[model samples]
Target: METKAISLGRSLSVPFVQELAKKGLISVPPRYVHTDQDPPIISLDSSSPQVPVIDMQRLLYEDFMDSELQKLDQACREWGFFQLINHEISSKLVGKVKLETEEFFTMPMEEKSKYVQQGDLEGYGNMFVLS
Candidate 1:
């Protein structure tokens, strides 16, 4: 009798998302379907206000600590999110990260589906689904 070894990195025969997209189906998947009240996608003005930019450099200073903290608090309280500035991460590194991210997202769905989650986990995912 011959014995065969199972490969951990082997992928499924077909990618589920690619197959669904090829069929022209665009409904939200089970994970994204909200059972609660519908959030407004737009207001009467339909304009997206600018996000607050919180400067980390100022937050680290003694004189600006309280003021920056208050600004951060206000941003969260009002906007639910804010853009972080002067985070100290190098610009070159940030650019590299952005480039790599674009590359990853541009890959063919069939190639990416190789990383689909199994019983426990897989590669990168939005916190909404991965969590």
Candidate 2:
């Protein structure tokens, strides 16, 4: 099979081999050329809207934790979710709980079954089902 060596810059235009040959850039050589079926078209018009920003600087500076709590409560009552800035919780405890929950769920079926509640009991009671 005969192969043609085409120039890089000439490849952008259609009939590149013929044009290159006519320009004395490359010899007229027999080769199998595959044209692009369809180049991919990307649309940048589609995008997600940004989330709303809530400012809590005044509440923090004034030491109005109660007012902030009330605001959070109101937000929960109105909007299901709200961004909080100056809230504090024990990271170690949160990490421990998360790790424990992950480990608990990943345990063997028999082992997980042992932790399952057969009846409603206090301390380890199913809070969701209860009043």
Which pairs, if any, clash in model 2?
Answer: none
What's the distance in Å from true for residue 61, model 1?
Answer: 0.8
Q: Which run of 10 residues does model 1 get worst, by summed lDDT?
A: 122-131
Tens-digit per-residue lDDT, 16-66, candidate 1: 454567778768566445677556456455475567889999999999999
- Listed in order, each prediction's TM-score against the native is 0.53, 0.32
lDDT of 2 by residue, 9-111 (tens): 3121123233355567543443322244343335555463222334466466567657766776777775557775534657787789989988876665557
Each prediction's whole-model lDDT (CA):
0.71, 0.51
Give per-residue lDDT, candidate 1, residue 91: 93
Best by TM-score: 1
lDDT of candidate 2 at residue 59, scale 0 to 100:
62
